[model samples]
Target: MEPSKSSDDKQVAPPRRVSFKYRSGPAALRCLSDGLVYFAKPSEFNDCLEAKFDHSSVADYIERMDRSIRSVSEQRSCAGGYAVPEGDLASFEAKTACDDVNFLEATQRVGIYSTASRPDNQPMWTYYSDNSKGFCFELEWPDTVLGRYQIAPVGVLYSSAARVHNRADIFDTLIREEAELHPDWSMDQILEETRSEFFRFRFQMLNTCRAVSIKHSDWSHEHEVRFVTPRAGPLPIMGQILKRVYFVRTDFPEWGPVMMLLHQLYPTVELAKMSFQHVEPYVRVQGMTKKLVPVHE
Candidate 1:
């Protein structure tokens, strides 16, 4: 009735722990997330999926599961922010009038409006990073135009999801290419170069933009969506630049399994569970609302 020595030894062995460390650069993180298991990173996502499902019919199951998850609306009002008033004829008309007058172009327009009307006291820069040395891009959707939106720089962190094949080479290529593009450079050359490429690519993507709008009778909403492209065209060059310094994760097949694990690890991680299957991999989450809300607490 006594247990064998082999069984006793097996029972005494410790269970392996899955540990993930944060990377310093964006490209490094992207590589790690893209199924490259170097440096103690999790790799072999397909194997992980197989282990989880215990079946070969992962494709069909995934397709069905994705559809179901996508069906669930992740829309919620941004935290500490009021919904921009809708259906107010007077306020709508006033905003239209203000926009029509090119008020933003005038030097004293915001000041003039502040004196004449109540200013919106909402914190405009919720996720500003002083280190980034640039501003986040804000895209405002127009209610009248089903899927129309305007893109503008807000404070200092722009949201994007771009994939790159190689990190170091790409970064070097971009720096050299940008430098050649702008010969007259000085101390602020690096900052200007990066920003120029970012905006240029962004506009290119915008030009070929296709709107991914969602609508519901329960809650109606629509917004324009586009990838931030490189100025050189729909090429990977700009994507590399963005991936190097910015926080972005490339769309990879392995991402599905990795995300599934992350979801299981933290069930209350909102929007983190949502997979960008066929569409652009990047979807901006409101900075204030990304905090994990505990299900039990």
Candidate 2:
């Protein structure tokens, strides 16, 4: 009898199974037969997770993978080095040595900063050695919602004993001799006239005695000071105020102590009133260009 149209449509297809070859290495195959741990299976004797090698020749590849994993783990753990306590400047200063005595020792003895501050919201402190290199410490604040954070080195301070005495003598002599020579010029006028000289002298003294020097020169005597940057070129300014006030404060209380404060202070009283503006559109364009361009070595 002939089959019906329904029977023809109901014809069955053969079953299909997907399979892959399992090639064993000499070491792994040997281990499998000897009841030893295979690379693909968990070992009964040890709790450690290890790649079972089929051959001893693949030991180098296993070692390389192990090293790479350990390196990545270590880097993640050391993402933030250390944190600074949140408190008044005085309290923070007191704990300077405690948080890391090793850092203090290195700074004082070898002129190096080993430990860095964790980045935090509270005003962070960064230690600088040789006035150029800086190490930041993170700070923790109790009142903020963010909890704690890190900050980079934004300022520096220095002190020197010899600078104090020398400055005193030089200023005294200049006042005496200049007053006698230019009696017509008032004390204020003389100071205004020789401001550049005073700045140069101060800079030289600091360079000789201190490890680091702030990057500013005084041209108070000149009608205008030129401000230059690598990317921005020269900055505009008013007359008779040629140089920016770079040094915040300096103190020479006695022969042994000479304190200098260096910081990213806000502009002086004059610049505060000027209409300083930034072009956000230009900045955005620059940022986009940087992102899209692929840098080549």
Candidate 3:
């Protein structure tokens, strides 16, 4: 199936055909043996504001709130020939507050497996690869298992400011206008229809690909790509997709075990040593132990 397009119908193009994953020695060993990678919850990440929703368009939220209140008021006025109850008004206010809180909290369920477009990034090795004591795996993504899980790697969008999720931007007035198209429908019918459409719109708008693919500009150096899923756990990886392993430190305590495991489990995988230079480009990969197969070949 084709990827679900956004309102603008655009997709995040991969920087290159291949992406890289940085892992500690133990994590690399585990992944090499089990052919699985962990998809961590957004909250588990170093970012304190991971998956936090900032729906700060007060005017838009109030506009929708007023429409809801008016709908209830009209219904109550018709039903008992009296004013809407104070309790019901309070309930509406409470529900609005709850929705905001729930949106922010629900990000815990989001699963993210982060990758980078470039393998040569210095900080990537320092921060993610146990300060270059671990290793990095260069893999071809969109493999069978990931595709089966409907997980696609999307390029992350970097912004100088926090991503502000405006409710008005997502659940646009199109649905309301669509409901208005049905002039013959009663207010009750319209309300029911609008509520149903609203939920459907929310589901489409709250997509993992679109919602979590954004980050603060501070992370721009990572050139990050992410395989996002609704659930967090060990995601299966097909063996053949792991093309190469680049080890930064031969002195890593488990180097022997890691090398042995790689040789046994992935004999055809090219092994390379990465080095740091004092020149302009600090990080470089050279001297592969195993010959790299030409892609076209």
Candidate 4:
């Protein structure tokens, strides 16, 4: 769905990017076998703060509620529509406040996110890839694959501290247009009609980015990128999105069958084994060495 037109919309040039997903052997096998990648909910994430943000605070909710009500009221008065009187606005704000918070919380729980990282992040392998006992998939964003699956990767924004987004103007234009279109309806009715649109635009706003793409700066080492969808489930992979597979240790006992299955299923994908080498004088930095080896039948 196209993002609603608003000042909050940001125009970003799409960059050519690739990402890597580290998975255990069984999980990788399941992904390849079913041709479906599981998009998990934030509640399933290891981080307790996974989709939490200051945008969900009561202060932000009240501000957004006030703006939406005022915008609708003004639009109706200007367009000669059914306008809500100023006195009744206090009651309207109180009622909509609950709806705003409820909808935001519901959307947060329903949204599903998938994550990947820069290929060279060793810690990602340790934490996510079963500590070198599993493997990683290198994914490229080919137009065909991304367009088919609707997978637009957003690079995570890492912040050193908490942020407060008091974005009261989020749904102003959209609600105004809706009021103009349905001039006969009361503000309550108009708002009810546009409830989904309001929350949808709110989540897509630049400040929030759907409440999933921002992370704490402490996690900057992962260099994470994420793909998000409102619906949570197995999304089938239809095109050549999987470019390569990196085995953390080919010597692992379970790799024999997993390799055979991978070769049988995705014969054209490049397979490689990853190892780390330490260079003297650069003690803090470790270089990843990969040997590209074809999977044999």
Candidate 5:
């Protein structure tokens, strides 16, 4: 009744412990009452149905869930500490909340918003390093938009699932609105346009940040989500600037399964590594340096 060994009969190392700070002791974290994914059973989604979702029921369910989330919302998280997509929304041109915007419009608006708001200069920063155990992008926010914004990192159980749910909620509402905007397009056309990950990533990156703070990166935030472009030293795998992002912070584990999850989430795009574990600063002394330069933390 024992486990197997490696090819060399050597012990394999267990995965590194995720660096997220521990919270209150175990009491099963309530999510959909029993770890449901996206507020409904997985079986609830069907691509072929005439009307796949019960919009009203889902809204009611989300309301109840929102109330519950608010109760625990004050808890801290790995969030980079900025205004996130879900929070910074102003009234879209459509004005009408739901069933007035479609996938294309939704994607296009964020694009416009992000491009319009980008700042000329951003603060230079290395990697994730914070004495308080928080990992946030350092940026020079314009005086008009800069302000103290706190964040609540997401819980482990709901990190990935919540994103799907959250994004889906935004998408579905837009789809319903699209029903209004594109009165002539068939559901098949609608579904096909919205299903591609390209649009999803385009829309996603456009979101995640209200104010642009990174120098060369596409996304930005004091605490929400920002990344470094390959020009600013992002991994080479991430393609052309503004299209693919390298790193971001959320209310979830930094070094946990998120790295893997992100890889799967955006197949073509590259995600910069952000480990949950604290990284020590490398030592460099004046004696060790031969050139004229200054290095400080």
Candidate 6:
């Protein structure tokens, strides 16, 4: 069990600030065995996370994960022991040693997220809304539905912090375009959604500290992700997960200290609707993390 870090203990030593940049392989979810605990059986595990993957698809999640793990290690070895080039100051959370300009143009940093609250599992998916976001999550024990659950590796989110504020605004424009695409929705509805999302985004940003999305390229996934770790099979492809209802647990003591307000919510909530006091509590308490900053961002 991950012992709760007493406030005083945190003052003594915190885990090295979790790299918001996701690292796959043994680093992210940490290991395949730990990730399997979230699954009920092996078949389901294979479906949701078999990195040795057997099927073929446009985006072979596991294959990509496997290759990424190897490639990143190689880059580190060749980096001459430097994490980044000495002078760039680019987003350090996720990057390849090359420092390609196209990489930045293709990606956007909207929120800065720290690592998910520490547990054996990392954030596979959590903190989503109808405009839901997931890829890491956890549930406490003794719960009727999901017991303590989580997956590893982590991903980037844009930071709402002052330094990145301008970049975040640039990223929000995508939401604006998405809002425009929905001609039938009302202004109040959109603002309410934005109001609550930003509230959660701000809080989540405070929690994790970065959310960055980059364009998909054969080479990029190798060094810059922690979200899927060989990826999940039973778990749906991330592209299919947006804008839907999701259930979130509120009683988990596991989240107790990580979220200062864990006791503030009821229990499971329908996250997508965005119209209830119950659901809003999580946005504050456990903001659903986006799967990854989508490639389009």
Q: State TM-scores per candidate.
A: 0.14, 0.15, 0.64, 0.63, 0.20, 0.21
Please write out the lDDT profile of model 5 over residues 105-187, one tens digit for every residue: 32222211111121111221122222212222112222222112111111111111112223333444445554556767655
* Candidate 2 per-residue lDDT over residues 30-120, each given as its tens digit: 3223322111112221213111111111233234434443343343442211123344545654553253343222222211111112111
Instruction: Tell me how far the alpha carbon of residue 182 in candidate 6 is from the true structure, in angstroms, after superposition.
Output: 2.5
lDDT tens readout by residue for model 3, 25-140? 88888788898878899878898766765665554565654565454436445331123356586766677578767665555676788898877778888878888888988988
Candidate 1, superposed: residue stretches over 4 Å from native: 1-221, 231-260, 263-297
- In candidate 3, residue 42 scores what lDDT? 87
**What TM-score does prediction 5 earn?**
0.20
Superior by TM-score: candidate 3 or candidate 6: 3
Task: Give the number of the best model, judged by lDDT.
Answer: 3
Per-residue lDDT over 1-297 for candidate 6, one digit per residue giving the tens place of the 0 to 100 score = 122233323456533322222222222222112322221222332123211111122123223433433343343342211123435435342332232232232222221122333221213222121112211223222221111222333443322222222232322443354355665655445445545766545433322222232222432322333332122233321111111112233343322232222112212311221112445343332233222133663
Ranking by TM-score: 3, 4, 6, 5, 2, 1
Q: How far out, in Å, is residue 114 in model 6? A: 14
lDDT of model 2, residue 293: 36
Comparing 5 and 6 on lDDT, the stronger one:
6
When summed lDDT is taken over every stretch of 10 residues in candidate 4, the lowest stretch is 282-291
Q: Candidate 5 at residue 212, lDDT?
A: 20
Model 1: per-residue Cα lDDT over 1-297, one tens digit each: 111223213455454211112222332334334522121111221123111111213233334433332222121111121123346656745654554243212211111000001011111111121222212222122232212212211111112222111112223344445555665554255335546867455433322221111112221111112221111111211111111111123243443443343244423322211112345644432211122345884
Q: Which stretches of candidate 5 lie over 4 Å from their true place?
A: 1-62, 65-104, 112-138, 145-158, 162-224, 227-297
Better of 1 and 4 by TM-score: 4
TM-score computed on alpha carbons, candidate 6: 0.21
Shift in Å, residue 130, candidate 2: 38
Angstrom error at residue 146, model 6: 12
